[model samples]
Target chain A: MTTLSNTQELPNGPVAAALLAGGAGAAMLGLATTLAEASAGVKNLLVWFNPVGPLSGKTGVAVITFFASWIVMHLIFRGKNVNFARATAVALTLLFIGLMGTFPPFFELFVKE
Target chain B: MSISPREGWTVLHGMLFGAAFLLAFAGGFAGLYSLRPEWVTAEGIKERILRLKVGLWAMALIAWATVISGTYIVYPWYRASDATSARSILLADPATAAWHTFGMEWKEHVGWLAPIAATVVAFAVTYYGPALAKKVGERRALMIFFVAAFATASIAGMFGAFINKVAPIR
Candidate 1:
């Protein structure tokens, strides 16, 4: 019987890839918000980007992004070796950028003129 | 200007949507602690962990939904030109004006942290938890994640309630 150590067992390729994908997906949503604000065309297409409107549209976008990325990552990492640390670093960078992208809408909504 | 019916429903839905996710997370944590390695069958432990993992994703989804809805509701309420500011809106009614000073000022800022923290915790647990727990006793890692998640959820709830009370649907 082959006994695998916990370190070698946990967060296998699929899991690491899923995490990285989720982060990237969230970043895309954040970037979308910025794009919606910067371009009138995007704003019209993604009305949910409106700071004053109902958030269902934006929520829907985020949901799509999450699942889409998860699926893509699952496929890409399937039967492949993954470096969890490197994947995490890349994902965190995307998430951070996405987070920064979200600021404009928050600013427009909260701060008084 | 009064909130549109669409925005109102979004806020209402977001508030109600939180209950199920909260229950999932809290229950998952409780179950984790309740399991005794010596007593529970290995299969039983795996099932529990699987449920907990699902809870992590559900928690993240709920956090995002709630944040989006709450922001939609509160942003316009905050920016209503007639009101000038959140404090001013509350000041319009002295009876509830005290809330503005109590913590409403920081509520939005603090509220923003909930989704961020929840997402991070979800990803952390999903990806790194098992391996990390192996390094730092399993019980301690589980406890740490639970505490952080619970704190974020509590803050999310508190600020949601505070914002609704101070600003209201209008």
Candidate 2:
């Protein structure tokens, strides 16, 4: 019965803006790599997706974003009858796609081989 | 249900180990008695034989218990959904869909039942830790660690929606 928003605050004001900020960051990194390496088409595509950062990584900003999310989830899910933790985890994962999909620094290191 | 395919691996392993130990014990008795009949004596042989039989019975009981617990692990795979249910949930291609579900369910069962009971129980413990923490906080958490670990593997399998993953994203 516990929805993702239940007992929880909306993440960081506007979700859209935050997601874009993250996405753009990733895109730039991809473009940067392309520019530095001398490749064109692949560079552009990489740049395009780069802004999103690495969504499924261990130590990147991606992880930080999720860790923040986990903290928030734990607080909201503390005593509710429904499964707030799982719901929040799902919500966090979606939000992270944008946040993690971007950011080159996060991508270069955190993601696993 | 009571009778499920999840028990298959559990049954196999249990039977293997149980039979191995039983054989070893039997061989031990035979070797000792055959090597010495007078000094070892008939009374000694009788006592050894009884001990060996008790050991076999204990092994048999444990093996049976493995078969029982295995049902839950197997249930999700072979018993959870009938063919019709799986077909509807999966992709348009029935063959691919069936194979997909089979693999996914197999992965879940393997992740849950195989390791902990046979190899290491810790694997299940970590997987279920968070969910359990949410349910009961820190108090009885440790006790449920093993159960949580095992169940979490199954939960992950169910959550993975392996069929969907394999289906074309388009």
Report, for all candidates in order, the number of backbone clashes.
0, 19
DockQ of 2: 0.02
What's the CA error at residue B105 for candidate 1, in Å?
Answer: 14
Q: Each prediction's DockQ?
A: 0.12, 0.02
Candidate 1's residue-wise lDDT over B1-170, tens digit each? 67777456645644565555566666756755655545555556556656666776777777667666666655556545576566577778878765654444333333343454455456545654334333233344335435544654565567556756666644
Clashing pairs in 1: none
- What TM-score against the true chain A does chain A of each candidate get? 0.71, 0.27
TM-score of chain A of 2: 0.27
Compute the lDDT for candidate 1. Answer: 0.55
Model 2 bad stretches (over 4 Å): A1-113, B1-40, B72-79, B82-170
Candidate closest to the true structure, highest DockQ: 1
Per-residue accuracy of model 1 over A1-113 as CA lDDT, tens digit each: 21113234553456555556556655665666556556656556765545554233444566577667777887888667676567656766765654555554342343332
lDDT by residue (A1-113, candidate 2, tens digit) is 32222223322212222222222332332333323234333334433223222211111322244335444544654343444333334333442342332223333343333
Cα lDDT, all candidates: 0.55, 0.33
